[model samples]
Each structure stands twice: as structure tokens, then as C-alpha cells.
Target: MDERISCILSSLKKAKLTPKFRESEIIQLENIRSATMEDISSVHSTSYISSREQVMAEEAVLGHLEHDELIKDW
Candidate 1:
């Protein structure tokens, strides 16, 4: 995370990009959660129905659906 942030700041620091708005003008944004299998299946023929609930891991926060399991089943 540190390396990624450093790279972004270093790259953009010399880019001469103007700020769209000041930090004081920044607005809070709401986060929308991921879609469930039932909701997704309505749009497609197949959907990944996760067998277990999600859990947080060190590397990443696991989603409600297991993407790897879904790919394997596919």
C-alpha cells in the first residue's frame, strides 16, 4: 500500500494537473455494496452462489461470493 501510494504521488507530482476542487470542497461519497447472486442471476443465466459467508483476510477482504470457486465451477 505504501509503495502504491508513493508511486501515484511521485508520478502525478510533476504532471502539472490542476485540482478540480479544493480539499475543503470535497464531498463525502456513499459506498454501494456488491450485488448478491440472486440479483445477478436475474441479468444472466448463471451466477456464483457462494457456499459460505464472507470473511476478512490479511491480503484482501473476501467478497460474499467466492470468485475463484465460481470460476472453478464454471
Candidate 2:
């Protein structure tokens, strides 16, 4: 999780406002494994999953993508 997001979640917990948040707002907190492999497979094609996993593995070793150039336009 990103530090900013972690801080936000911590603040929410401290405020005791989580239950007041709607289901959609809290969906991002659902555990990554909440979905079964079969369920994920249903949504993602086999090749797409393989390619994304490969990219993630490579990023883990090489570090995150440099977004400075991309963000300049935005």
C-alpha cells in the first residue's frame, strides 16, 4: 500500500467513520485474495494475466516506472 493511502486509512480508523462509508467506497479495502483464482481467471484472460504478472515481476527488480515525462502533459 502507498504511504498516503495508509495514512488516510489510519485517519479513517481513528475517526471511526469506516462503517459510515458506502460499500463502493470501501471496496478498495477488500483483501487481494478475497477473490479465488478461478474467479480472477474468469475476469482476466490467461495471456493478459501472464503478461501483467511478468511486468510486475520485472518492475519489482528494476524499480517503479518513471512517470515524470507522462505527468508533464497532465
Candidate 3:
């Protein structure tokens, strides 16, 4: 067996048992993918998203950003 798979199986065997995993755990995993663009827009204003995109683009071109400046804004 692959080392990774063996390690994972061993870990699983060692895990403490509890009540069986619930249906909610499955539902949460199914929604792990990102929300649609419309969903994102609904949460954040369109203008804010556009401005954030521009800032990220500029940072990519510059190759580095000022950490303190970014944290201060946050």
C-alpha cells in the first residue's frame, strides 16, 4: 500500500469512536466549493469587489505589498 494511505488508515483506526457522524457533516462538505459570483455580490457591494480586484491586480504586478499597510487597512 502507498505510505500515505497506510498512514491515513492507521490514523483512522486510532481515532476515538463517538456517535455515528451526522447528516449535517455531509451537507457542510458538499458546500465547500466557492459561492457563485451573484452570491458573492449579494454579500459584498459590487463596487467593493471591483476595487478589491484592482488592488490585487496591482499587488501582483508590483510583486510585493507593504504588510503593515495592508494589516492597518484590515
TM-score of each: 0.24, 0.39, 0.40
Candidate 2 lDDT over residue span 1-74, tens digit each: 33454587678667755645543454544555566778889999999778766766875677764434322222
Off by over 4 Å in 1: 1-29, 47-74
Report clash pairs, candidate 3.
none
Best lDDT among the predictions, by candidate number: 2
Tell me which of candidates 1 and 2 scores higher on TM-score. 2
- Which window of ten consecutive residues has the lowest lDDT sum in model 1? 47-56
List the RMSD of every prediction in angstroms. Answer: 12.6, 11.7, 15.8
Error of 2 at 34 (Å): 4.0
- In the range 1-74, model 3's lDDT, one tens digit per residue, is 22453465456445622113333343334547767888889899989889767776876788764544432321
Would you list the rank order by lDDT, best first? 2, 3, 1
Candidate with the larger lDDT of 1 and 3:
3
For 27-65, candidate 1 gives per-residue lDDT tens digits of 656897788767776866532222122122422452334
- Looking at model 3, residue 67 earns an lDDT score of 42
Clashes of 2: 0
TM-score of 3: 0.40
